[model samples]
Target: MNLRFGLPQPLLSFTLLLVWLMLAGASAGNVVLGLVLAWLLPLFTQGFWPDNPAIHKPWKLVWYVLKVIVDIVVASITVARLVLSFRREPNSAFICYPLTLEHPLGITMLASTISLTPGTVSADISDDYKMLLIHALDVTDDEALMADIHKRYEKPLLELFS
Candidate 1:
C-alpha cells in the first residue's frame, strides 16, 4: 500500500464498486457481478487514476450531491411552470457569474451541475476560467441568480474540491 497512488486504494475500490452497482441495477446477482467487476477492472487500469486534490471530507461530498439533486428537481418545476405559462416569460438571457473556485475539476463539476438542471445551461467559461456564463430560462434578477448559485452549488463544491 504505497502512498504513490495518492488516494487510498480502498477509496478508489469503493467508488468503482458503487459505480458498478449503479450500472448493473439492484439485483443480488448483479450486485455480486458488480463487485467482481469492480475488483478486477481497477487492477488492469491502475495508471489511469490521477493524483490530484485529495478529498478530505466525505460528508461534504454527500451533501454536495444531495443539494444538486434537490436543485435539479426545483429547477425542473420552475422550467415546467415557465413553459406552461404561455408567453408570459421572456426568453432566457446569458448571465456572467464571477467565480472564485479555480480548480479545473471544480469548475467542470459546476458546469455539469448547471447543465443538468432544467431552465439553465452553461454557455461558456471565460478564457481565464474565472467567470461562467450561464443562460437562464427567466432572467429576472441577475444578482439573485448568482447568489443562489454561489450559496447552493459553488460553496459546497469549493469545500469538496478546492
Candidate 2:
C-alpha cells in the first residue's frame, strides 16, 4: 500500500478551505465541497508553482501579521492627517529600496505589504529582483524610511520565507 498522500501546498490548501468555509458557512455540504475544492485546486495548480515556500517560524509569521495591521492603522491616520494638513504639501517621491531577500514569494509579500499600507504604494521591482520601487505620499527622510521597511517588514519576511 502506497501511503504517500498529502496536499502539495498544505498551508495554502488549508487556508483556502478555511476561507471557503467562512464564506460558504459550516454546513456539511459546504464543508464537503470546500474540502474537495481545496484539495483539488492545489493539485491542479501545482505545476504553476516554481518552488514551494516554507515558513520556518509560524509564531514569527503571526507577529509579522500583527505588526502589519498596526502599521496599516498608523499609516491610515498619517495619510488622513496629511490630506487635511494646511501647513505644507506632502513630500511625495519614488524610492528605490534595495532587496536583501532573494525568494520570489518573499519579495512578493514585501511588495504587497508596502502597497497595503496607506500613503505608500509598491510601484515596481527591478529586472534582477534587486530593488523595489515605492511611491511614498510624504517622506522627508529616505534613510529613515528604508530602515523602517527593512527592519519591520523585510527582515521578518526573510526569516519566514528563507
Candidate 3:
C-alpha cells in the first residue's frame, strides 16, 4: 500500500491515544474512546500529517527531560532565596550568548527550556540564529551563567535534537 502520509501510522495513533487518555483522566470508558478516536482521527487527517525526523537516540531525550526538571527545581529555590534575602541585588540585564546548534527544533527546545526555568527568561533569538538573548533575574557572572546554560541545557538538547 502506498501511504500518502510519510510517517508511521501506528506510532501516530498510539501517541494520540496516550494523549487522549491523559486528558480524559484515564477512565476505562475514556481509554476505549481514546483508542477509537486515535485510530479514526489519524486516518481522517492522514493527508495533513507532516514528516517527523527520526530520533537518533531516545535515551538522550529522556535524560534531557530529567535534567530540565532538576534545573527548574534548583533555580526555583535559588530565586526564592534571592527574593527573600532583602539584599540590594542589581537589576537583571540581558545577555546574548552565541549558539552553535542550527536546527530549528533544537533552538525552539532551548528557548522553551530556558524560559521555563526560574530566574531566567528567553528574551529573543537573533534572526540569523547565531545568538540567544536571555534575561537573568540576578545579573551575577554573565560568563558563568552562559556556560552553565550551555552545559546544563543546550549541550544535552544538541544530543537529543541535533
Give each prediction's root-mean-square deviation over alpha carbons: 4.8, 3.4, 4.0
Candidates 2 and 3, the one with greater lDDT: 2
Q: Total clashing residue pairs per candidate?
A: 0, 0, 0
- For each candidate, the alpha-carbon lDDT, in order, equals 0.82, 0.92, 0.84
What's each prediction's TM-score?
Answer: 0.70, 0.80, 0.73
**lDDT string, candidate 1, 26-138, tens digits:** 89998888767666676666677555666667699888888889988988888888888896966678999999888888899899999999988999999999999999988
Between the candidate structures 1 and 2, which one is better when assessed by lDDT?
2
Best by TM-score: 2
The Cα error of candidate 2 at residue 71, in Å, is 0.9
Q: What lDDT is reached at residue 42 by model 2? A: 86
Clashing pairs in 1: none
- Most lDDT-accurate candidate: 2
Higher TM-score: candidate 2 or 3?
2
Clashing pairs in 2: none
Shift of residue 20 alpha carbon in model 3, Å: 6.1
User: What tens-digit string does per-residue lDDT give for candidate 3 at 1-162?
Assistant: 235443337777889988888888898899989988877887788777655545678899888999899989998998889998886775698999899787777888899999999988999999999999999998778999999989988888777665
